[model samples]
Each structure stands twice: as C-alpha cells, then as structure tokens.
Target: MPARTPWIRTFLCRSDNIGVLMRDPETGACAAIDVPEAAPVLAALKETGWTLTDILVTHRHADHVEGIPEVKRATGAKVTAPAKAGAAVPEVDVTVSEGDTVSVGALAGEVWETPGHCADHVSYVFAEAGVVFAGDTLFTLGCGRVLEGPPETLWRSLSRFLPLPDETQIYSGHDYVGSNARFALAADPDNARLKARAEEAQRAAAEGRFLIPSSLGEEKATNPFLRAGDPALAQGVGLAPGSEAERVFVALRAWKNRF
Candidate 1:
C-alpha cells in the first residue's frame, strides 16, 4: 500500500482580497502564498500560531506583493519570486525560475514560470501538499485576463497547468468564483456541471462560505477557459468547430473579460 502523505493545514485569510496560508505540521512554519495587504496577513499569522518562514509571490501585482515589506519586517521571512519580477519585488531574497524548488521546513514546492497575466508571473506547485498557488494566472473556473501578454501566451500558461495530476488542488489569488461561474454559464449555458456549480457557488456565498481551492479535474470539467478545446465550448463562443484550441481559448478569455 502507498504511504499516506502528511496533511498540511491550509487557511484562507479571506481579507476581501486574497491571502493563503500553508502551514508545515511538524515545524510550525508557514508559507504565505500572496500578501494582498498587511493587516489581514499579520492577523492570519497570529491566528495560525505559525511563524512565517517564506513568502511565495506568484506575480508582481501590488495586490499580491504589496504587503511583503510589512510582513517581512514583522516576521523576517525569506521572499521567493520570479527572476524577471525582481524590479517589482525588490525584497525577494531568492530568485526562482521554472523548475526551481523552494522549501519551508518540511514543505517543498517547485516554481513554474507562468507568464501571461504578467511577463513575470509564476506558479508554485507544492507536490507533497497537492496544491498550486496560481496567482492571477488561473482562477476557479476562470483565468486572468491578458493584461500584458498575447492571448497565445495566456493559452500556453494555462496549458502548462492542465496536465498536472488530475486531483491537484488549485488555489488562485482572488475570490472570483461567483463571477467566474456567471461567465461560465454564459459561455456554456447548457453544461450541467457549470449550471450546478454556479448555483452551488451562489448558495455557498449566501451562506458565507468561501468557494476556492478547486481541483484540476473539476476545472477541466467546468472551467470554460480550460475547456476551450472542447467542440462544445468552441461552438458556444461562435468559433468554428474545428478551430484551433488556442483560438478558442483566446476568444473565450476575451469574452470573459467583457463578461
């Protein structure tokens, strides 16, 4: 029988913005996924009772990295970010690129350069934890807009994530599940999974439960951005049935931005 992997507790700061905390069970060390603001981040640290050991910045967005200095000043944790994002994130102690590994106590993660939302964007894959800090690149049932790069770049970035083990959990930088679900419904109105998910998200929000950390398998089934290659998705967007996957993806994303 395969040995059980240690379970790490994940906390959603839910600060009306984004911040995720991953704590190492053995060492009581915590890795901050993205610090949207300082106050909530500090509060999360206090609530978790875990000392901050590292900060993983997926992009140079102010909302994501603006709190680095304050958090660092308070906890003195090492900051790891993309090499190209150095100018934006001056406090990053370690510059990492695609395939580079970072560890906080017993927790380890690999950095995947995922440039599209921004040229310097990257995603951290914590294999042992079965989670990916996708920043603004990918969201629950949606994805980031092409603010800086070509649609092709965004498509490539999204594609790189598709093949991860199906059960891999995705933790995005924003809480846009309801909005994403609305767009997904417009993009594929007849999709039962999309319809059910949209309803479920509405109910969850009404009850004040955060809908996040969606699985890759679930995204593959429901996210219009990730399912752009499907013939039905192409049809919904008025693309030719035989359209290239990238073209369909680009159209779907363009539509969602306006959605």
Candidate 2:
C-alpha cells in the first residue's frame, strides 16, 4: 500500500482581522493567505520557523494585500492572485482564474472564483487537506458584505461550497465568529444548535481563543447566511418560503450588517 501524505499545518495569525499560514510539514515551505501587514506576518513566520514560498491574495482589499510588498521584499516569495486583480496586486508573479492550480511543496490547491465581496475575489481549495482558504467571501457563520456584486452573486459564490464533503473545513479571512454567532442566533432564535454553538463561541472568545475553521456540516446546520433559501430561515425573517433565494440572502445580509 502507498503511504498516506500527512496534511499540511495551518496556523492562524490571529491579527486584528485575519492572516493564515499554510505550511508544508515535510519541506518547511509555507504559503501565506492574505497578508494584512508585514510586521505581524514576519513575526508569525519567525515564530513558526517556516520559510514563505508563496502568497495567495484573495482580493484587492488593502487589508488583504497591503503587506504583500513588505513580505515579498523580505522573503522574495512568489505571489498568486486573481486575473482580474492584476492592477490591485502590486507584485503578482502569477495571475490565475477559476480552475487553475497552484502548488507549494507537495501540496496542490485549486483556485475557485468566488466573487461577491469583491468582483475579483477567489478562494483556494486544498482538496487533499480538506481545507478552503475562503478569503472574505465566506465566514464561519456569515458571509462578506455585498460590496461589488449583487446579493445573488454572493449567494452563488457561497453556494458553490455547499456540495463539498461535509468535513471540509472553512478558513475565512476574519475572526468575526462571535458577531456572526450573535446574528445567527437572531436569525434562528429557536434553533437549539445555534444557541448552543453561540454560547460555546462566546466562552471561547472570552478565553482569548478564536472560533474558526468551522466545518461545512456545522455551517449548513446553523449558518443563516448559508441557509438563506431554507424554509426555516425565510420563516424566521417573515419571508415566504416561495421567495427567491437571492431575496432571502439580501434580507439576511442587510439584517446582519446591523447586527
């Protein structure tokens, strides 16, 4: 029998927003996911003792790519970004669209066009690792705001992930788990699962731990944003079940923005 390759290690930078490190354990090669700033990223790299080999930029947002130059200067790492985000990314070494593949060490990742939060947004899926670096497109129990596309666009982007294996872990760009959980509760107040998860998340945050990398199964069950088309979600917000999925998603997003 062939030996199984161990999964790569993922480290959350836990910056004010989000930055993550995907390290190939065998080679000590690392890939950074959206560097908000260079200092924190450098510190994180030093702490982990991993050499950065590449950077995956999800969108053109400053918070996501501001540190690209600095990190690149320090490590000379190759950069990969969406083809549409060429101008926004200053030092992109490779530009890819949907279905393209990128590699670091022995691990391979496929690019998924996930626009909505930004027209140029993308997500990277490491199938072998069962993880998705979901930029600002999808959060733990929430999704990004509709800044550049219609709510339907965002809904479609999010829906693409629904068919993945139930155990696929979602690593989002922000640690907005607590806020999202609160909104989830409001959207499904009577859901025992949501309530239980929210309480657990609150306690985790209080203890200075982040609630993230939420499983797809957990999300499908409690994330109102992901369940916009569900009858329970529509009923919770007083919308009829026959309403369009986009309409439900829009209403839920608008409500959560205030939440």
Candidate 3:
C-alpha cells in the first residue's frame, strides 16, 4: 500500500491568523492546527463534512488556543497541546514534547520542540505527508518575533526545517506574506528570486489569495531569515561576507523588528 495524501484546507481567521484543517481520507480523522477562532473551524468542518477529531496546538498564545473549549464542546474532539505550555492552554487531552508522535487516524506527525516564538512552541512535521505546521516559529518570508528566547534560539528552531526536502509544504500560523515580502526585498535586494516572489505576493494579494503553505524550497530561495548564511543576505544587512549566520540572523531580525 502507498501513503495517502491528507486533504488540507487553509482559511483566514482573527484578522490575520491562518486556520488549517487536515483530514485523513482513509479514516475520516481530521485535525485543526490551531483554533484562532471557533466559528471558522466549525464552518470549515461543516462545509467539508469532515469530522473534527483533534486540535493540535503549536503554542500557548491566546490567539492560537482561545477557541479550543468551544470547538471541543461542539465536536468532542481531543486536544493535543505542548507540554511546556502547561496551564496557559486549555482543554488539552494530550501533552507532547520533542520526538512525540501525534496520530490522526493512520497519519502521524513528529512533534518538534520548536520553541522561539514562545517557550512552549512546537511544530508538527508530517514528513511522509510532506507537510509541517509551523506555528508562529516561521512565516511566509519571515520568522516569529523573538518574544521568549534569543534570536539564536529562534534560528535553531528554524533550522529544524532546513533538512527537509525542497518540496516540503510549510503551513505557518499567520498570513504576513505581504509585509514579509517587502522586508525580504529590503533585506536581500540582490536576489532575483526574492524580487519575483515579492511580485507574486503582490499579485496574490491583489487577487484576494494568500501565500500560505509555501514550499520549503520557495522559502529557502526567498526568505531572508532562512538565508542568513548567504553572502548576499549578509551584505544586505551591512555585514561582511562569511559573517556568522547566527549573527546575521540576529541583525536581520532586529532590522525587521524596526522595519
């Protein structure tokens, strides 16, 4: 038997937060990456007719878990939260840490302790499915704000995705591609790929579409945060070639913070 691809749906919620629903066709088991809000998740389930089986939380942020209780009460779905989140998140039926496997029917995702956006942040990498639900740790062309740990920690967390295949699909927590594209252009103006991606982002926004679920390949080629080791990015950030990637990354993030 071959591995079946899980069906995925992406929608906007809570102004900029992205809502995701992943369903296993073999067993009809469905999981929502983060709630953001209950209405959209419920409506999506109703529209797709996919039963909500689980809610996988990436971090303890209120925007991510605020809809858990209502959604759980309505669907009786199990909730899987990060162990480090502790009491910050509610209605957690299971707490997972690094290397833990979370199963939604026959589909399984390896839990990576990708803490940088927050102390409890975790990313779900369904390698076989070629998908990773990266909460706030990574975005379209940027990374999360360093709120909990140093930029080095966030760089380490982002590095977890570096080893994945180019085609791996990444679903981040928010829709910040427009701003990220602008920032990417400012940070790596010499990269033609970044320029093209920024134009694509502009067109997508004009068409009322989003650039969520971007491939690791695209991110690597265009995202400045992921290209900290590239000499072009180092120079763009006013650093010399061969500068430490971690140092470049910190400078880039600081520039982004002020950008």
lDDT of each: 0.83, 0.84, 0.94
TM-score to true structure, per model: 0.94, 0.93, 0.98
63-145: candidate 2 lDDT, tens digit per residue: 88988999999999999999999698879999999999988787788999999999999999887878889999999888999
lDDT of each residue in 179-235, candidate 1, tens digit only: 899889988888998888888899988987756778898899999999988999999
Model 1 is weakest, by summed lDDT over 10 consecutive residues, at: 1-10
Shift of residue 170 alpha carbon in model 2, Å = 0.7
Candidate 3 lDDT over 6-122, as tens digits, reads: 999999899999999999988999999999999999999999999999999999999999999999999999999999999999999999999999999989999999987888999
Report the number of backbone clashes for model 3. Answer: 0
The list of candidate 1 runs beyond 4 A from truth reads 1-16
* Candidate 2 vs candidate 3, lDDT winner: 3
Ranking by TM-score: 3, 1, 2
- Candidate 1: the clashing residue pairs are none
Per-candidate RMSD, Å? 2.0, 2.4, 1.3
Better of 1 and 3 by lDDT: 3
Comparing 1 and 2 by lDDT, which wins? 2
